[model samples]
Structure formats: structure tokens, C-alpha cells
Target: MKEVIRSADPRIAALIARQATQNRDRDQLGLDRISALLEAVGRPQDRLPPIFHVAGTNGKGSTCAFLRAALEAAGKRVHAFTSPHLVRYNERIRIAGKLIEDAQLGELMDRVLDANEELGASLFEVNTAVAFLAFSEAPADACILEVGLGGRLDATNVVEKPLVCGIASLGLDHQAFLGDTLNEVAAEKAGIAKRGVPLVTQIYPSAIAERIGEIAHDVGAIWEPRGLHWEAGVRQGKLRYRDRQGAMDLPLPRLPGKYQAMNAALAVAMLRHQSQIAIPASAYGAAMGWTQWPARLQQLHGGPLFAMLPKGSELWVDGGHNPSAAQLVADYAKRQWTDRLPLVLLFASLQSKDAAGTLRPFKGIATEVLTLPIDGHECRTPRELAHLAESMGLPARPCSSLSSAMTALAKPARVLVFGSLYMAGELLALNGPLPD
Candidate 1:
């Protein structure tokens, strides 16, 4: 998906526009161009601090957030890189405990573009190179790198030796780039394992877990699957963790939904198994309440967009666009809003997504689905989505915009804006909290 970015700084905007025109598909699923691009920029990946590389179909970003919060709470300056920024491109790159400033971001983008005079790299490849370039020069104790795509060929996988690697909850997503089957997707995520490095993962099905074990064995990695080596969950209104080291009782993540408990546990597992940094038990508890990932069950307290809605109405948003993600969202909605009537959904998705499968889980949960087209991308048409929803026995209607949808609603209700991350980003811009 190509993003049409709007930056507050003119210099930064101009540099981003210039870099957007070079080799869009050159780094679709390979590291050749990225390696050359990094070499041109002095091979910064080799000079960085200890890295904690994370990859999976879902909850990987949340796991990275958990890791950063715990590290920071322990008085460590942490650098983090996450994808599909909710509002600005600056959200993708975070320098030592802060979002990169405008002047430095412009300078870094310019430096990377200037070095790639002969090499045509994709936008993501250049962005990855810029992250390593900046992290190498900045002073930080640890770095958390999230894989933008599948783990095997993602540009972030160029790091030779990481302190630890983590794989979060796995499901079917990006089938065009990864594979259509669960086994193939698990393999792509397991490729990040390195010799002598601990690959801490949330337990999967028997066959998928065995497949990942095979890859780790072939690469000489220490494979530690959950339920065998370490495990954690909300047992009695408190998070319970147990491993070979010991057992820990911690607070659950403040993030909504039950799935977040596992993500926080993955971060705890990664931090505990690694020897690079020493974190106190208090820091792990601090992370549960401190960590926040926007557009994932985020509620709008007050904003320009909120004033347009009806009174006593609640607005929630999420960036889940796959079948597995939708199932989780539906579960959260039913458990949270069972008493509320007229559960409305304003949704859109990209062209390559499985719209039918994505909407299947929410058929009976939604009161009315308002379909809209996402701006500046090849998105599903509103009429097309409405038809699909109807086929699945859902009450759906096509609308031109949010205002039109609001006017068409019959009564007060709860609204959930979900489907595409790109759509979630646009909604956040209209809503509050632009990712600092």
C-alpha cells in the first residue's frame, strides 16, 4: 500500500516526496537493494546497540511497545521502529525515547536520498536504512526493531545478531506476499532466528510449532515455545507467568481485549530470557499500565469529529483488517458492549484484502455497517462491501462519507471504525492524539 503523506515541515515534505518516486516495488520482499543502500550509508546496522527483533502477523507492534515501555521504565534509553504510522511518517522512527524531531528527520531523509544516487530502493527500504543510520549515531542502550513484512526477506532482518527474537500471535495475512497457508506464514516469521539467540514465541498449534522448531534447529537457534519453556495469562484477574527461571505475578495490560495479555507476556518473556539488560520486576508491572498503541481499540474522548456524533454515543477504532483480527474485535465488542443497542461500524479496506473473510466474524455483532472508500489508495468500493455484508447476513449500507452515515443512522448507538490501517490513520488525524 502506497501512502500519500502530509508533513508539517515543508522541507521534510519535499524530501519525502522526492524519495517516494524512486523504485516503489524494488524491495517488495528482498534485501539486495536494502543491503546496498545501507552499505552506501556506512553499514550502520553493524554499529547499533543490542537489538530485540520482533515479527508476526498480529500483536507484534504491541509486543514491541511493551518491550520499549519496560526498558524505558528501567532507566534505559530505548530506540524503537514501528510500521503503518497512525498519523505522521515521523511516527515510524523513534530516536532515544522520543519521536525524531522535524529538522533531524528532514536531514536524515535527505542524507539517505543523497547517498542512493545510483541505487533505486523502495520507500520502505530507504526508510529502514535511515532508521539504522540514525540509531547507529544516536546513543541508546537498546533497540526494538519490528518487521514491516514477513521476517525472512524484510529489510529489518538484515541485522546479523540480535539480543533476542520474538514471534507474537500468528494468523493468515498478506497472503500475496507471504503464503496462503498457516505453515508457510509461520516459516516466514521464524526466519529471524539466529544461532545462539533465543527465539521466544507464543505457542501455536502442534503442526505450526513443529514447523518453527525445524527452522530453528536448522539454523542452530535456541527455540523456546510458550507452554513448554515460558507461559503467562490472566489466571485470576492478574497476569501469571512461569518459566524455568521462576514464576512471576504481574498486572495485565491496560489495552482492551483479552489478546493483549499474551502480547505483554511475549515482551516479558523476551526481556527475561535476554542477558544484555537487567530490568527489575517493578518495571514489568509498570509497562502493563504505561504501554499504549493507538488505533487499536482506541476511544475518542473529545475531538472535532466527536462533536458531530449523536449524544450518548461511543466511538472506538481499530486497525484490524484480516479474519483473525476481526474475530478478536468481535469478541471484544460482545464482551464490552452487550447492553448497548444499534452497534454501528464505519469500515473500509484495501484492494488486496479478503473483505468477505474479514467481515464474516462481525455479521451478527454489528447492528448496521456503513461502508466507505478509503482515500488515496485502491480501496474496496462502498457498494461492493455492502453487497458482501448482505450476503453474509449483515445489515449494511453504502455511504458517501462519515457525515452522511451519521445522518442516516436511526438512533443513538456505538460506532466502531475498523478494517484498514490506512483508514485508521486517517481517522486518527480527524480524532485526537496524533502519536506525539
Candidate 2:
């Protein structure tokens, strides 16, 4: 999918606009451009602190959040890079423990873009180069990187030797770039495995696990999978985690959804398996409450958008656009709202996503689905989406806007606005508690 970015700072915006015009293909995926770009900028990837590189179809961002939270709780200074900013462009790069200032970000953008005179680098490549440059020049104990797409040729994969590498839950996403089958997608993600580096991963089916183990063996990486190397689960009310080093009873993550516990466990395994960083057992317990990744089943309390709903109504939002992610959201809603309250869905998805697969999980659970169009994106038409939903026996209607849909709700209901992350960003811009 093509990425669209805007900055409030004029200097940054101008550079992004110029770069967008120079490259005709915005979604180019390869390490050649990024490698050359970094070479031109002094090869910052080689000068960074201990790095923790993570890649997967989903939950990678949350894992990064968990890693950051745990490190910060240990009183360590950390740098992180995540993609697809929710509110502002600066959200993608965290310099030590805070977002990069506008002046510094603009300067970095100018430097990276100026170096890309003839490389025809994609926007994401430029973003990666800028992040690496900033991270190399800063002082931090660790740097956590979330892969932008499939791991093998992704720009973030330019880092040769990371302290530890982790793979979150595997799923069939980006089929056009990765592959068609589940094994193919798993191979693409496991490509991050490096020689002698421990490749920590979540549990997968037997066939998929065998495929990943083959790749790990080919690369000479030590495969540390969940079921075999470490185990974690929610037992009685707390999280029970056990590994070779020792066992600890950690607190459950503050983030909603039971799946978050697995993401947190991955972070713990990645941290414990590595020898470069020293993390106390207490840090793992504290990380459960400190971790925060917005737009994944986030609830809105007060804002311009929140006031539009009827009195006593609950507003929830998620940025899940794939079948696997949608299934999680559906399951969570089924468990949380079984008290006879009406469940309404405000949905939108990009043209690249599987709209039918995403909407199929919410068919019997949602009382009604109100379809909307995503601004500045190639999204399915509201009418077409409504027809698709209706065909699946889900009562749906096309609405002009979120305001109109919210206004049409005559009584109190539990409303879930989900699908495209762009739509989630739009809602955050109109609501409170933007991602920081």
C-alpha cells in the first residue's frame, strides 16, 4: 500500500512534497535504496547501540511498545522507530525517550532527501534513513525497530547484527508482496534471522513452525519458539511466564484484549534471551502497566467525536484491517458486550485489504454495520461495502460521514469504529488522547 504523510512544520512538509514528486512509485520495497542512502549518510546503522529488531504481520508494534516500556522501567534510555503515524509525522521516530523535535526532524529530512538526488528512493526509504541517522547520533541504551513490511527486503532489515531479533504472531498479510500461502508469509517474516542471533518467535502451526525452523537453520540462527523455549499464559488473574533463565509471575498488560499478553511475553523473551542488556525481573512486572500502543481496541472518553454519540453510549476504536486482526476484535466484543447492549460497527477499509474477510467475522456479532469512505485513500465505496455486508446477512447502510452515523443512533449503544488505520487517525484528529 502507498503511504501518505503530512507534517505541520512547513520545512518538513515541503521536503516530503518534493520527494513525493520525484519518485513515481511510492511503495517500492527493497534494501538497495536504503543501503545506498545509509552509505551516503555515513552508515549510521553500524554506529547504533544494542538493537532489537522485530518483524511480523501484526503485534510487532505492541511488542516494541512492551520492549520500550520494560527498558524504561529499568531506568534505561531507549530509542524506537514505528511506522504509520497516528496523529503527526514525528510519532514515527523517538529520539531518546521523546519524539524528535520539529527543527531536528526537518534538518534530518533535508539531509536524507538531499542525499537522494538520483537514487529515486521511496518515501519509506527516506523515512528509514532519517531514523537511522537520528538514532546513530543520539545516546541511548537500546534501539527498537519495527519492520515496515515483509522482513527480508524491508528497509529496516539493513541492520546486519542486532542484539536480538523477534517475530510476533504470523498471519497472511501483504500477500502481493510476501506470497500467497501461510508458509510463504512465514518465510518472508523469518528472513530477519541472522547468524548466531537468537530468533525468538510466537507459537505457530506445525507446518509453519517447521518452515520457520528451516529458515533459521539455513541462516544459523538459534530458534527460540514460544512453546518449546518459553511459556506464558493468563492463569487465575495474573500472567504466568516461565523460561530457561527462571520463572516469574508478571502483571497482565494494561492494554485491552487477551492477545496483548502474548505480545508482552515476546518482548520478555527477546530481552531475557539477549546478553547485551541487563533487565531486572521487576522491570518485566512494571512493563505490563507501562506499555501503551494506541488505536488497537482503544476507547475514547471525551472529545469532539465522543460528544456526538448519544448519551450513555460507549465508543471504541481499532485499526485492524486484516482477517486475523478482525477476528480478535470480534471475539473481544463478544466477550465484553454480552449484556444486551446494541453493538454497532462503523467500518472502512482500503482497497488493498480483504473487506469481505474482515467483515465476515463481525457478521453475527454486530447489530449493524455503517460503512464510510476513507479520505485520500483508494477505499471501497460505501454503497459497495454496504452491499457486501448485506449479502453476508449483516444489516448495513452507507452513511455520509461518522457524524451522520452517530446522529442516526436513536438509543444508547456500544459503537465500534474499526478497519483502516487512516480512518483511526482521522478519528484521533477529531477526538482526544492522540498517540504520543
Candidate 3:
């Protein structure tokens, strides 16, 4: 994995190598080390612009994308910090609506590493501190921070105040860190809510919603749920949003999948609720047409990988690995394949994931499954995934690599390469750079 990481600066490469080695030896999920690291770095987290912090098992990245688009649409500069860069480490830190430059990123990493030499900070913690340092020095209207793990103890939770906080779709993920149940997961995500801040959320089961509300109340944060404080619906090809402030009609999200509408709406609601930057109605309309999140039902277009397939073939990629995400993918595919086209699945996942549960949703929809391995993660062997697929009554084959699986395609089929972000990263690197 280190060999594949590309940067124009040698210092950036050295910093990444050192952090990767440190992570391999001392990676743990908690805030104690991160807190000390940030303190050593001059407590940059406290100096960020008004922040919009978000957390969830899925859709959090999409939500961040929507927020950036809306802020940029309003002609305001925005700083965004996300996790697990699909192809480049630069993707994790966006300063003023652009990926951080290699020289600047290298310098920031060196400063962070030097300050936290004895703290043994994990890779994610060090990355988070660097982002904060950059954001603190740069000028931006707002900052969007996405939780890298369970929110309560996530490295991004050091912010004491934010303009707004949001929790996108929640489900069972990272069970070892968060709890096993949906309610428990909701509670962990709700940990980002700060005193006097507005926390927006999507509709959820009563139990899950109640738990999140309890956490919000405990932290002195105001809970503004979708169905209660505001609401959004799609009608006649438009998104109808209504809240106490007022009502507005905006274009539907340009992103694929019905779930994205909720994410876009959440961003709209958060912007509308906060008056920090004065987002006009026009910005809301622009966001609907401008936002895009890659690797979430993304269609491959005009690339080496696409040319290898039959004419008019569709190749899609999604990095959804949890059971809840699997169900969403299955539902989306059911609607997409209503014309009854053959669906071929090229999949890989980490070892800790439940392969059976994740693949169960596509049992009837997927015509065949090609199981492969995620190159750098502790993933299930291709043979093990094949056995799981067979038990589920789905035709399965083991492939040594993604290239091998693509070569076995009989015709131009509606192919889906999913199951892990690491696999999606590899595909994007091979196909071409992601669309700007």
C-alpha cells in the first residue's frame, strides 16, 4: 500500500511511511493520544472556523460532499476533512474547496509528527491533527469534519463547538468500537452534538431516535430531527423542503440513488438552520445540481477498464460493506435492473465483516458473484467468499484479482464492483483519476 501512495514531495512520502508503520504497530481507537497530540500542536482544533461536524455508519461522505457543494455554490470558501482517501491522501484534506497541495501537506505532516513523537498517535489521529493545523491557518467560511470512526472517541470530536452537527443514515458498523445494536450505534454517532449546537438527523426507528435524543439532551444540544423539526419529499422531479424558517423548492440531487436525496436534504436543512454564512435560496438550488460523491453508485465512463468490456456495457462501483449498506444496494439494484438485465457482482470485503449477511441482500438480484481480495486489508480469502456465496444459492467464482474477474466477463453485463472502499480505491486508480 505504501508503494502505491504517490506524492511529488519526498517529505510527504517519508511522513506517510512513518505514519503507516506507526499505525501498524500502535493503532487503537480513543481520544487520549489524539488529545495530547493536538495539545502539543498548539490546539489547532479550537481555532477552526464555524464547523459542521457529521457522523454515521454510511452516507456521511455524501453528506460532506453536499455541504461543500452548497457552501461553494454560495460563493463561500469551505474547508473539508474526510477519511480513508480512496486513491490519494490529499483527498482527505481539502483546504478552501481544493485538495491540499503536496508541499503543504508534507510540511503539515512533518510538524504534526515532530510534535507528537512520544505520544504514539495513530495514523488517523496524526492525519486529523494535520488537517486541523491547516484549517486553522487557512481562511474559510466554514469547516466540514467527518468522523473517522465511532464519534464519541473519534479523533475529530475534539471540537468543543460547531455551527451545526448532523448524523446521516446509521446502522451496525464497527461493532467492536460501537455497540452491536442500532440504538447503540446511533448513540455513538450522536456523541458529536455539542452544547447549544443544532444537531440535524434523518428519520429512524423510535428506539434509535429516542437514544439519540437522549444523548443530545444529555450534552445540551438541540435535537432537530427530520420528521419533527423539518421534512423533505420528492414530487414531480423536485425536492420539496419545509421547515420552521420557510419552504423552498430545489432540484433533486445529481447523485444517483434515492438515499442521496435525504443526505442532500440534511445538508440543506443544516445550512438553513445556521445563520453563520447567510446561504441564499439560490445556493440551495445550485447544490442539488452540483454535488457529486464518487464510488457511490458511480458509472465508469470512457476508461481502459470500460473499453475492455463489451459495447454499451455498464460498470458501476460502490464502497458499501455493511449489511445495512448491502440492503440499500440491493434495493437500488432492484429498481435499476427492473428491465431484467444480467447483474454481475465483483466483490471484496474485510475479514471482520459478515460476508453472508452483506451478500444476502443481493441473493436474487445478482446473477453471479466474483469474490476477490482487498489488497492491503485483512480481507476474506476469495475461496471463503465463494463458499459463502454458494451457500446463499448464488453462483460464485473465486478470482485471483480484479483484472482476472473482469477478463472472465462473458458479455457486456451490468457489473457492480463493491464490498470495500479499498477495492474501490484500486479500481479508481486503475481506471483513471476521479472526476474533478
Winning model by lDDT? 2
TM-score of 2: 0.98
Write the candidate numbers in order of decreasing TM-score: 2, 1, 3
Q: lDDT tens string, model 2, 1-436?
A: 5788877788888999988876655566778888998999899999889999999888999999999999999999999999888889999999889999899998998899888888878888989999999999999999999999989989999999999999999887789999988899999999999999999999999999999999999999999999999999988878889999888898899999889999999999999999888999899999999998889888888888788888989998899989999998899888877888889999998888999999999988999999999987889999999999999999999987878888878888898999888888888887868788
**Top candidate, metric TM-score:** 2
Residue 84 of model 3 has an lDDT of: 77
Q: Give a tens-digit lDDT track for model 1, residues 1-436.
A: 4645667679987887788776656526788888999999899999889999999999999999999999998999999988978788889899998998787888888989997767778788878988898899999999999999989999899999999999999999988888999999999999999999999999899999999999999999999899999988888888999888899999888998889989999999999999879999999999999999998898877777666778888788899999899999999888888795678999887888988888888888898899989887888899999998888898899988766776677677888888988888877887676876
lDDT of each: 0.88, 0.91, 0.88
Ranked candidates, highest lDDT first? 2, 1, 3
Please write out the lDDT profile of model 3 over residues 145-246, one tens digit for every residue: 999887988989989898999999998887877889998889889989999999999999999999999999998998999999999988898889999998
Comparison by lDDT, 2 against 3, better one: 2
What's model 2's overall lDDT? Answer: 0.91
lDDT of prediction 3: 0.88
Q: 2 in model 2: Cα distance from truth in Å? A: 1.7
Which whole-number lDDT from 0 to 100 does residue 394 have in model 1? 88
